[model samples]
Target: MGTKESDGVDPRVLRTRRDVVDAATELFVTEGWSVVTHAEVARRAGYSKATVYAHWPTRLDLMRASIGKICDEADHPEPTGDLRADLVRGLVDFAEDLAGGHLDRVLGGLLERSGSDPVVDELRRRLYEAGTRSLEGVLRSHLPEVDVEPSLALLVGGVLTRGAFQGRPATEEFVADLVDRVLASTGRGEEG
Candidate 1:
């Protein structure tokens, strides 16, 4: 195990850390990260504050680790040649929580913690880069006829984020409409 490996951090430490993150995700989704305390997370995880501290020295670390887990769960845009389908799949995955106001709440709490926490921006950048690559792959596949800029992958991501902002939930029907729009815009429609 390398220094970066979680396994190297002691089995007890890893378990305790995972517990904190799991508890924080559950609590943050409901109580919002702003109000969630280490003590609360520790209690929920059936651990002590000192144990939580043993893994996460500060609240930001706990928040970032938890968000990182969520972001990892959201990694999508499976490498199907049909970018339209891939984008739709990714959107559905990313926007489900958005439409239900989960994304807004999650981002709101994260942004508050990140305002002064340097780790937030760094972690967010990493997550954004990862998500952007997934979207770009889909867009290039769907828009092969057009010049696709990888940087513009954000457009596809934004569409879903915008849906979340527009108060749309990740419903099968709404996802279908989004898929239609994405396919049509990307020249994946029948005409294309």
Candidate 2:
């Protein structure tokens, strides 16, 4: 098994580490972030408490690991040639993932922690990156010659503001309209 210090760790150890992280992810999502402890994760993962600590020494470490797993597991839709449809689809998926119960609460908890913990801030940044990557990809593909910053900002910021900040529903129709407006401003509307 992979120890805390070894690279040539056994496969079993790697599996155990993965199991531990998976358990942490479930705990963080289902329960509040406060409920995640090494002991609880160890019990959920069926690993020893020592193993959990060996892999993630601090609660912050465990949170980071769990958040990383969540980000890694995010679904990104592939950009078809139809930019509008792709943008709408991606935005809707993004909103749903963010607005869904477990993820929404997890994000809220992270934001609450971010003010005091740099590690939590970094985790939030990583989550934001993961969330916007698909939109960026679509913008880059469709507006290859144009600077994608404005459009990317509109898509991400608009969606987040409406869905998370304003607590409005990001329905498919809303996403479609948002995409249309953004693309229209960029001169890449229905014609493009």
Clash pairs detected, candidate 1:
99-168, 99-169
Lowest-lDDT window of 10 residues in candidate 2? 1-10
Residue-level lDDT of model 1, residues 19-118, one tens digit each, is 7889998787777877678889989999989988877888877877777777666645447666555656666666665556366567666566565756
lDDT (C-alpha) at residue 163 in model 2: 88
- Best candidate per lDDT, number? 2
TM-score, model 1 to reference:
0.73
**How far is each candidate from the true structure, as Cα RMSD in Å?**
3.8, 3.2
Clashing residue pairs in candidate 2 (N, C-alpha, C atoms within 3 angstroms): 1-13
Instruction: Output the lDDT of residue 72, model 1.
Output: 68
